[model samples]
Target: MLNHYSLWKYLIVILVFTTGVIYTLPSLYGDNPTIYITQYITEENHQTLDNILLSQIKKILENETITHKSISLQTNKILIQFFCEKDQLKAYQKLLTIFINKYQIFLCTTPAAPYWLSVIKAKPIKLGLDLCGGIYFVIHVNTEVILNKLQEQYIDTVKATLFEKKIPYIKIYKIKNHGIEINFKNSNYRNKSIIPLSKINHGLVIHRIEDNKLHIIFSEIKKHEICERAVQQNSTILYHRIHQLGITEPLVQRHGIDRIIIELPGIQDIKKVKKILSTTASLEFRLVNSAISDFDINNNLIPEDSEIKLTNNGYLVPLYKQIILSGNYIVNSNTSLDEYNRPQVNITLDKIGSTIISNFTKNNIGKTIATLFVEYKDSGKKDSKGHPLLIKHEKIINIATIQSQLGNSFRIVGISNLNEARHLSLLLRMGTLITPVHIEEERIIGPMLGKKNITQGFTACTLGILTSICFMVLWYRYFGLIASIALIANLILMISTMSIIPGMVLTMPSIAGIILTLSVAIDANVLINERIKEELKQGKPVQYAIYTGYRKAFTSIVDANITTIITSIILYLIGTGPIKGFAITTIIGVGTSMFTSIIGTRAVVNLVYGKKNVNKLSI
Candidate 1:
């Protein structure tokens, strides 16, 4: 008589499949419509919005009779989650118009996992951007501009040190060799000033040259530091800016020394993206003077300390070099319609800027103040000599006369449209970029295409599994039917195992991995069956062949799966995005297949064939 599995072995199998069933519960519940209300919520708004939004949502739900699974008021966000897509869409369409400048509403999809399951930290596999709709951008920052700006800032420091130390110099200017050249009255003045310059930090090197000139240069180490810092700070700015645009979990990564890679999942609006990402905004408030003598428009400018700026209205205004206030002092910005029904930007300054602006306007009541707009873009124009330049082009976006003394709050009138007003407001809130950037690569993935891909991938997986099941049953007969049952068990265990793993993404390539796993699952079954046939042909008893077959096949199965597992580990470590997805699923599926193909199929064999004393074998 054949031996049945021991109680402990039966208990182990039961425990594993039970755990698999529990984990599989999450995948059974499909995705639901999700609404996210993300905004830069201040403490005052946080307390006020709780009750206001709750009441508003109540009224909206009462009118529409739409019920939501949960309404979570998180920090900096409000999430209205529902199991039904129609209800989610209806609430989104109704509530989005109300937030306005207060918040941004985005429609998304999330699994309708139960509260208890979520409490246990269980979640279904996340879909990748390649499988979900999204946009990709490769942005290249102009490190030259960053370096040039840093040099100019340091030049001011150098000038200050000379004045503070009372070192006499004739003239100082930036040189083409990434250094500043300072000319003294004589070599004695330059040599005497060298001691003071030696006290300077900020990675500046001062060297004396011929003709009473001293050169201040940045070392190679400092240049490398500048490049690294430029990328890091810009990445932080882009992350903040994207979140402000209502995107969750966006990937803003550093590619090279001056390049950045950005991925926004579930975003399809290219225009909105351009407005948020492409605009390089900087604000400057300067006094426009009546010093026409200061400007020789034919010669490009008039004074060293002042420059002639052309306004949008075709008027040339000479602005002082000193900026009274910049975007750094801004506290908030909002878009609204003016008394003339034209789009306008209402800006609020910080406490310091408020005091400064109030005093400046009071002293220059009849004077004209200009708001200089600095933008970074490739204007698609060549230089006079046919060379191209991507630079920060500064012009006067708005120029208004000071009728009376104004305070921290002011309006920017004459915006072309409401869209312009909104875009400007967003830029001001996000702050200005340290340097200009260009979008070197752009791609858009529509939601429709994403859905099509999902359908095709899922259909292909289903067809593949069915074909394998049919072939297994036809060739192996009773044993094949048993193998097919284990195949089903293998799939359930694979999905459940994958779902439990943290941060696993189910992508298109991952489907291929799944199908490949199923094929590999049959290989194990084939090994066990062929070994059993060989033992039976050698005149061994059915019971001995059954036991011996498994003993011999186990080694081969271990060796084959071990190699595959190692390859998958390598792939996961080195791959990106979809490739990582494939590797993760493959690794998990291989482990699950090993168990189901050996232990699971053998348990069935023991329960059916092991309990009898028949000499005939099914295979």
Candidate 2:
């Protein structure tokens, strides 16, 4: 009983906490300090629009004493950069639209860089793919790769089993058509291998041929494990990559065995995301043996193309191929400017990579490297003279004095702009952007779509409850009215639970979960009402029947609901995304339903039973 009360108290606490949560999220997320808003006006007469927006913003910034700059007009756009607060976001939107009725102005917010900045008039409440658009890539994990891995695992298991019994096998590999290729001299061991392995749930479809090769077809279950492993590996890789990208709450989930879904809300530059995802980030450092001309680098004397492209700076690079030294090798990287005010990136290498780099540099200390090839490309066409030509340019420079205490750490000099330096650092960290992936499926909901979805979802929920309430009153009379009241309280508890729970995500699927809960709440009431009718028909007194009906229903309701809750728990443990959402709501709803139906409805029923006489009861 104490545990039950504590649960109810928890529900109440959640309710109170949720009201505060709803009010606080907008402030925390909306008033982010790093947002910049810029407005583009293609035509005239938008000066008044700009002034009005400035005034509204100025009024809001008064508390912070943040002096509002009058909007600055550039070539095609008027830029406004300020920290936005929650209470002011709605008003800011209204101010921007004040001249929408008159002027032909184009307004848009750039996707914030590195997932922190926003270029909106306000921090957008509903994140859209356009405003926060990034890349969406789905790689079809090859089934053949999974099968091969499984085959290797099976082969290892078999080898261990055979070696224990003093049997020897030449080699093992999975045959393309279907089965295992095992070349063992002993036929007795091969026959024995099949019987024990078959019983081990390996799910191999067995086919024995007269030849040495044993044909095996993997069952759906066995094949599925391969795909599952691939998916898990991909998810892990993506999780690490997203962390490297420094994105908060990025959606990295497996859609199926072979497909993954990634959502970087408020990310701009889909191209950048694609580049980041496709890079393996494999870093290596090789000695620049001798300065080579661009012509030699491009002419296939070098292996594959390198990833690096030399700017004005002289250094050896990967030329868009795999990096010799990746960000992983660098224990740390920082940004600085050179003496000429040009941007430069400093990187500190890890112990191993540093050792390799140090040794390589030490070995080539006195080499006067005149040319360091940064980029090599197949020109593919002849010059104006029409002769077959491959253009190669030498961008590598002579080696400067190498610093000894610096270990493997080095600096890239001569970046033209701060943005360029930043880009270079990112590319270096990402380990060269070669063959970057592109967005396969991009779903962007604009502000208008968000509003529509919100309106529709709310309307659907309201109508569902209203309809349920009407049915309950019409059918069960006074007791039904009591159940209806309980249902409303149940809903409040659901909202409160969702709002206050730390890991809960109130997604579209969660709304359906709530509605499903409402249905279950109604079902419990129906069960109680029917049980009451049964008691009254057996000649029990009105009050006695009412009390007995609830008492009898309580055990059955608890038993049934407990089973449902357990199932939902199992689902939650095994599922992901929307499935988990459904499971979560089901669990919360079932627990809450037991309270409102068993306690809340009973409380109201006791009040009604007290008001009525001894012998008459309305169902």
Candidate 3:
């Protein structure tokens, strides 16, 4: 009984090892090359893929003699799984060429794990960008646009304040470089307006420009604060959007004063990813200017406070400049079908937006309202400082008459297709970018390089493990073999834990951590074996020596592992990117190694040499 384990202890060890193997089995299976097809939403056209489109794709593949595993329809998209990467690439090229304007295509990979394993949600450990290959982007946020917007907002504020204080002005407009200029009828009115404007202390610098004008500009400190805030806000928004895409371990961080660096590991949809990241789209609800007839619009009689925008059907409609609601107030949005089975976006607004919409709808019972869709896009032209210029696009997506008082929840019709509706809903729900961003640099890491890195990492891990096994066996014989087995179990348990945990990514540094863990496990076994040898040399009996060796070695093993676990914790807390990846594996590996090296090896040793008749030990 000295070295024997109880029934419950044996069962616990068996259960843990079996569970580790079961979870590790999923990683042995490979991934299938696949193609994902969705509607390419554009300003002029949006169309979802249907059964007809699926048939067309199938026909095209058959005609080209491209072998495909299966073709199926998914939510808002179509998926085609192929047996190999060659066929996947060929099919992607063929489909893209034929449906260039109608659909967006992406080359991707999905798990080929069996149905049973998938049912249990078993998955392989995620690979990092360096190992799995993905798209890397360097984005430049346009801080100047934010400044311009702030200045425009301040212009309204100044106008309201001066008017309320009974100050007269001839005209107020933005200056050529920065800030705003207000021209007064005379010097006295401008001087009188200065005091009221000074009360709005939002970092505004009010200067008397000549006798009858005042020039207002943001102070240097205020401009810097605005730029920093915009960059930080954009970074946060990008993080949310990337996570919504279901990408794990994406890197979204600020690089320079106005630039963001993003690394999306294992992502292959370049076009869709770019659209989601760079497109600054928002919605504005404005009341329709019903007084402006079409005849007057055609003759260029648009009002000063109203602008004419074209609808989706190519008809021009006049809408008031005042916005009743903006996308910023939207808390949630989803895609749904309307009464006529047309695609629509269901929206839920915050309290303030709800109040604004309710008040407006209550006052104008029969008045018409227009939904203005706005986007800022790169114009492919750079400014003097080499930054891309942005073009603001606005269109009336929908115009509807008020049937009743509206509140927090409503649906907008006139979306071209389901895909478009989904895209709009995703953007609105994730929130819009504060300013337009352009891709300053982009790099695509091919799967070939990724495969090479993975191969190298696998080779390194296997070599390290083999070396550790051979050394342990040659030194301690039978006891060394038990330690080797425990070492292997430690590796399995570590990998399984990584797979089970969310957001654990395997990188080159993680591989190094695994190798180090194997050494640590071997060290623990060596300490126990040496202790047994020492006890036997001191003339202790065989069973007593074995029990005493394990008992004496437990404290040293725990102390060393505890120190390592603490160090790993500190690394994880202070590190970023690759360092974090390494730290995560080290932490998990150290924990598993402690269990295998002490508890697991002991279980096996007790079964092998825990008898009263034993007189000598192999180790």
Candidate 2, 121-204: lDDT as tens digits: 222233323323434455443344346535655655666666666666667766774456777566666676676556545577
Better of 2 and 3 by TM-score: 3
What TM-score quantifies how close candidate 1 is to the native fold? 0.65
Candidate 2 backbone overlaps, count: 20
Give the candidate number with the greatest TM-score.
Answer: 3
Worst 10 residues of 2 by lDDT: 38-47
Model 3 residue 502 lDDT score? 79
What is candidate 2's local distance difference test score? 0.56
Best by lDDT: 3
Q: What is the TM-score of each candidate against the true structure?
A: 0.65, 0.52, 0.81
| Model 3 lDDT at residue 233 | 88
- For each of the candidates, the C-alpha root-mean-square deviation to the true structure, in angstroms, is 8.9, 12.8, 4.8
What is the per-residue lDDT of model 1 for residues 265-286, given as tens digits with 9 covering 90 to 100? 6766555565567667788898
Estimate the TM-score for candidate 3: 0.81
- Summing lDDT over every window of 10 consecutive residues in candidate 3, give the lowest-scoring window: 39-48
Candidate 3: regions farther than 4 A off: 1-7, 43-45, 55-65, 158-259, 265-272, 288-322, 329-356, 363-368, 411-431, 610-613
